[model samples]
Target: MTRTALVVRGGWDGHQPIEATDLFLPFLRDSGFEVTIEDSPEVYRDAERLAATDLILQSVTMSEISAEALTGLRAAVAAGTGLAGWHGGIADSYRNSSDYLQLVGGQFATHPSTHPDARHGEASDNFLDYTVEITDLGRTHEITRDIADFTLHTEQYWVLHDDLIDVLATTTHPVQPYHPWHRPIVSPAVWTRLWGEGRIFVATPGHSPEVLQDDNVRTIVERGLLWAARSE
Candidate 1:
């Protein structure tokens, strides 16, 4: 049977929700999923619609979801619907909702400036050359297997997460001479969490359409969407 995948996108135009999500349409179709698109999180209010959905791909960054809509989304996922997203689309969305943060198992704290002396107003301030290191579990996990450590010159997310998540890959933020921190900080770059019978997959590397199209990032996200979907 064909699976149903819902794509909810809108918020923070800086992330280019439409263009980013568009990159994956062909893959979803090729994977035999009947795709549906909603421009707002208001669609989450339709509990019945969410119930029938096998997977949800959210791309809304820094947006708000009403209490009713948030409740419905949690219920759908708790009842076994899968959830998947990348970058701020999932990790940094709905900052005001603590419930949403707990459900996703992580939150974007900040992306440290690349250079201590760099100006804050420009985009390049947060863009840094970093490496995503696949963990031992990632080497064997379906979502990251055979994917070697890779490097990217982009925004590397520094997330605040809990032990509930199973980390697949990580990126480290080094301590610059100008920063106050003494130790290097490591953050999860890719991860999955189990909530009830549902599955959630999050990747923090897709800061733009170009980053999402990277071979490693694209492959992992493709596999993650399939892995998170409800069982047939």
Candidate 2:
């Protein structure tokens, strides 16, 4: 049977939800997903719509979801509908919504930058380099299996996460000018977890379509979506 995959894209344009989600469309289609795209999270209120979904790719950034909408979403995931997202879309989204944070297994606190860019004169200039080391768990996980370590020049997500999450890939952050904290913070760059029978996948790398277009991000996210769909 053809699986149903919902792609909801909207929120802060800085994350370019439309463009970023667009990069994953062909993959979803090629993988046998009957794709549905929505520009708002309000679509979650349609109980019948969500009940028919197999997987959901939420690309909204810091947008607030209504209590009713969030209730529908949380119920669907817990009842075996898969959820997947990246960056601020899934991680940094709805800061005030503690339930959403718990559901995703993390909250984006900040993206610490170690770079000293006196030229730009702002902290945003500090988006520096980072390496994502695929973990042993990743080597065995269906989504990232056979993939090697990768690097990205984007925001290194410093998230407040649940320890029970199955960490797939990680990046070590060092103390720097912008990040005055002493100690190398080990952060999860990719992870997967179970919410009831549902699977959740998150990759904190897509800052733009260019970033999502990276060969590694593209391949991993594609497989990740397939894995979330339980298509294998």
- Give me the candidate number with maximum lDDT: 1
Q: Model 2 over residues 1-232: C-alpha lDDT tens digits?
A: 8989999989899898988898888888887889999999889999899989999999999988999989988888887888998888898887778888888997788887544544366545647688989999899988888889988887788877898689999888877656568888988888888888788889888888888888888778887787777443
> CA lDDT, every prediction?
0.95, 0.85
Kindly provide the TM-score of model 1 when superposed on the true structure, using C-alpha atoms: 0.98
Model 2 misplaced regions, further than 4 Å: 114-116, 119-124, 230-232
TM-score between model 2 and native: 0.94
Clashing pairs in 1: none
lDDT of 1 at 229: 95
